[model samples]
Target chain A: MKKFLSLHSLLSLICLLLVANNIKYLFVFIMSRQKVLNEVYYEPGYQFHTFLPHLKGVEKAGYITDLSVNRESNDGAYLQAQYYLAPTILELEDINYPYFIIDSKNTDFIIRTIKETKARRLANNEYGQALMKRPAP
Target chain B: MITIGYFLSFLLGRLTLDRCLKENVRLLHPCAAALLALVSGLGLSALLTFLTFVVLDSFHRPVIILVNISAIIIFLFFNRNLYIQKTIIPITDWLPWTKFRWFHFLYILLGVFIVGVAYVIALTHPYGEWDAWAIWNLKTRFLIVSDSWNLIFTDLHYHTHPDYPLLLPFINTWIYCFSADNLHPIPMVTNIIFVIGCGGFLCCTLYQIRKFSFPFLMGLIMFTTPSYLYLGTFQYADSLIAFFLLINLYFITMFQKTKDASWLNILGLSLGLTAFVKNEGLLMALILMFVVSVYILIDKNNRVGKSAVKHLLFTFLITFIPVLIFKVFIAPPNDDILPNINTSNFTAERFQILYNAVITEIFHEKWCYMWIVVLALLISRIWRAFNRENIILSIFFIIYSSAIVCIYVLNGKADLSWWLETSLSRILFSLLPALVFFGVHLHYSKQRGAHV
Candidate 1:
């Protein structure tokens, strides 16, 4: 009659919960669960992201058009990118994407960046005024 | 470091033994409550990990998930059988299928009217802060593009701030993983939900703790604070941490009434999660753990001392494990990293640095400093409340609020000043529930819905 509802039973119950929770934790480790979500293509471009340097062309298109970070993709400061050593210009208009860090190569990096593929895309899609763009010099 | 096992052991040891609340009066079923909590907790936990792997392309350690699931299950088990017979915890209640009564209609109206307004803004606009773009979204993008998630640790440059918590990423990852879409609709949605949830939780907590009609002065103060509204729509973790901190405080207060040990564990757990969400709350929680424990020792003939000691140890070990692991092996040796904050390497040299960092910032910062103002307000209120003999509540506020401020300020350096200035004051949203308690002045003699 006294076999149940004792402190021991309660303790045992806790142990059970601890063990039950442990199951998922263990499965994730032992099973080596592998899952695939999306395909992300990152080609070298001069996109001025403080998080990751995108091809500069992609950045200019958005800057001219004033697109949000997520919409433009080249937004975040690369978490620990040594390339973006300068202070990033933080923006608030958009939450998902805010600011881009200037690349480290200074004037030369900016000048050499005119030939980027994404840059050409921006140049072609200009609501015209491609020549209005300032010379790299 | 205390493993999840030890934390569980401590909570289990302290779990409410008697079925006091559920003994006679009954409205809902306990088993039903446990079932509801278990399913949601498990699903959410699994979903977090599943999403993390999907987004980052690697499996994260399931320790926190499992711990949460365990805590929820145990709490539901004890909570249902003994305490307040309210089986439907309402947050995940199953009554959506039922036709609404007038009271239910009122609840719906309130939740929808305010949250709906917030959601509309989130849908149409982009986040406002540069941090959201430069850091949170940047990391999200990398995780989306990456082949495996585990590389996040090895690929240090892949992150925005290595010190930032993983919860936000996991949240976004969960959505991305299922839809198989890299572009982030999930984080935006999460930011929206987090804001709405914070508002909803605050309303409920204010009403429950004070037993009053809808809040007007305090609620408006909270809802319209510039940063409250501004950051809510942004993608940063500060607002989210504030929400978690408020909920954690609520849980602690409720736990006191029940004498349920699980509440303490849950409280500690929430702080840990909050810390994992943002460095600000983590810093606060750490300081409070120390101050509150010491305060407890000074009062009630050492009653608080033992409990405080146990809880402090457990809280430190359980809540800080991820950070510890990150600092120990994950975070590459950057001389810039705050060494004293990490327990695994709490050398005297580093500890002194941590101590210096905290003091220099606090004493040197002008009136704009958050800790100074909040601490001043908190101290006076504490003294007045104590004189009025409101001992327990005073101690509680001091330890909880001051802990985050003191610890983080101590750990921070001059470079971290911007981080502190931009955050601590704005993060007051985290104190919503606690603020509700402080301002709450209703009494049983006053009618249930009556305001002061």
Candidate 2:
């Protein structure tokens, strides 16, 4: 009993229990193929990758989205878009720029934003995301 | 190619440490030295990369590689004597393992299991959590792809925390200097190394001081914490801060024991690196410097002389040069923090909210009762908690925690609960390993002879 209660034994027991607890989560994490969590947030960015060629030499572009800016719910998609299309700064809601990246689920909202900003849709990935160009005035 | 870059960096670090220590029998332990080399090498590489950017106005990959290779050649030549002398005995020689214990096997198995879990997580979340893409890796992308890397500090990228230090991104940028493309795996791999490095370093340092059982236990305790592994793989700078903090604490403990000026110099360098990891690290470096300076001055045993203190401060300032240049010249003013500072929010109610949030986090399930164990240990030995050996750490925790609280309390921007919810866990997470080390050291110091 004394041996069992020794510092080594007690610490070992705690560690054993902790490891056992962690194994349960490990199995769950593996089986779930938790890559989906990343894919959900990253899909919009991945879709934007095809538009990178169109954005060449374009140093900065305005970003238009139906999602609320600066909110937590909107940050992931917005930031991911900004990350995927880098060296090309995505100025949120500033349509004064000559180029724009449209990320919105609503078809009307995308068309309206492009039309309102006097920009024409130049390229897009079919999942309701696109790149728009504004001709010189 | 990235692997080759990382290896060269590691070699650079090992050779640098070997040259600096120079066959100091009491100071060099193979495992501890190896761990220190990995971090220091990577950090030095990052600093060199930053300097290259400053000089060339771009991240010229070939030049970066050539520079690192040149530095490595210089270190190799200087460290040749170390190779010839055959110093650095194997860690097993210091251990008392005449016969294999079942406990040793169990510990090894646990270590392997933890590392496997970390790798699995890293592979799944290759881009890492939101901040990695938003802030850290985002900066790395700019550092690589942008014609003007200075643009990252402009108001345009404020959401990306432009004011934050650039050590992690610079390290990733250094790795990318080897590859033609910015691979997703680079940051993921880098973070995993830090995670494993922290655990390995903690285990080795403890083993070097108080061998075998307690060291393994501390390693297991660290590995078992779910958040430590999860946040580590998230590719954030918190893990880097934790690693540097552990290094600082280890060297501080060593300096306290041996009064070796070399250890004090290493502590200064480590603390300087800590400041480069994040703003919190800068705060920590200040607090640690103040506490350690006070300890040195008031030490009952007048072993540490003024010359030793000068060495410590000198090394700290020298390593801190890059951080100074980056902060003053490159990075823009912090929008979220410094510019928005206000004392109007420091009400009794705000303090109450902050207090509740901290207490809740202390008992959060993510910690796996580790904090509870620390609390229990403290309560059990309240008297010895502030002994000469432990008081520096005790003071650091108090002052640092209070400073963090003041940041939250005084800041007018960002909702109080929202800020705490987003950040408090990570702030605590960064300190968790060092906190555990202190707890174990305190317990063992009281129970046994003061080896730690």
Best by lDDT: 2
Residues B1-452, model 1: lDDT tens digits: 21232233223322321222222112212222232222223223423453335444553335434544565576657665333444423323333344345675666675565565555444434433556655666555545544454444444333245555566665554344445443445666667656665655555444443322323323333443333444577777766665665655544444434443444554555555565565666565665455444544564544333564565457545646754554465544433335545443435654455456556644542212323433443453443455322344455566665655444545533333444555554455456435544444222113344222
The runs of at least 3 residues in candidate 2 whose Cα sits more than 4 Å from the true structure, single-residue gaps closed, are: A1-12, A23-44, A71-73, A105-112, B24-29, B85-110, B208-215, B446-451
Residue B120 local lDDT, model 2: 77
Chain B, per-candidate TM-score: 0.63, 0.91
Residue-by-residue lDDT tens digits, candidate 2, B419-441: 88888888887887797778777
Write down the TM-score for model 1.
0.55
**CAPRI verdict (incorrect, acceptable, medium, high) for model 1:** incorrect
lDDT score, residue B42, model 2?
A: 93
TM-scores for every candidate against the unseen true structure = 0.55, 0.91
Q: In order, what lDDT does every prediction score?
A: 0.43, 0.78
